[model samples]
Target: MMRLIFAAMSGALFGAGLLISGMTDPARVQGWLDIFGDWDPTLGFVMAGAILPMAVAWRIAARRAVSFTGRALPTPPNPVIDRNLVTGAVLFGLGWGIAGLCPGPAMASLGFGGLPFAVFFLSMAAGMILFGLWNRR
Candidate 1:
């Protein structure tokens, strides 16, 4: 129950941050990707905003035995740049470039009315399910 509450609070905070940062806007995201054209550097600022805090958090977590909620922390990230990682990254990038919304922003943008976002969110969910089923085989 406490874990669920914390998860909900974290998710709400993330969604609020996305909304406040204008990341929920697909056009803005797409504009950031438009390097050859009119590229927007706002995403860089946002990326830095996210990365800096996470870097600090990871350093803090490195020394901690358990999380603030008294749960065991996951192991450090895998540093290997293997084929699977590259392939997955390419696919993810292509999807993000095409749709202008990754999973986080897609989930966040659902509250705003837009057929495209709805489709993207559903498709993303379906992809996750399909990937899970495929991986189990």
Candidate 2:
């Protein structure tokens, strides 16, 4: 019950941050990606701000003996970059460029009930489902 409450609070905070940072707007993200044209660096700053807290939290969590869940968070055994990682990254960038919304911001933006965001979120979920089905083969 406590963990569920914490999770909900954390999600709300994250969504509020995205809304406040203008990341929920696809046009803002598209502007940031438009380097050759009228590029916007605001999203870069927002990302940096977001990562700083996460990095500090990660370091603290790493040094701790156990998490709030009473279990040790396992450290990654291997962190090597591979071809699949590179391919996934390329595909992610391409999708972001074309759709103007990544998963996090897309989910956050759904509160607005806009058609474009609805379409993007539906397609994103369908793609994930298809990928899982294909991988199960």
User: After TM-score superposition, what is the CA distance of residue 79 in candidate 1 from its true location, in Å?
Assistant: 2.1
Q: What are the per-residue Cα lDDT tens digits for candidate 1 across 1-137?
A: 99999899999999998888778888889999999999999999889999998899999999999999899999877887899889999999999998788889999989884898899999999999999999999
Model 2, span 1-137: residue lDDT tens: 88899899999998999999988887888999999999999999998999999889888888888887877876755789899889988999999998788998889989894898999999999999998999899
Q: How much lDDT does candidate 1 score?
A: 0.91
Model 2: what TM-score? 0.93
TM-scores for candidates 1 onward, in order: 0.93, 0.93
- What lDDT score is found at residue 69 in candidate 1? 85
Candidate 1 deviant stretches above 4 angstroms: none
Q: Candidate 1, clashing residue pairs?
A: none
Model-by-model lDDT, in order? 0.91, 0.89
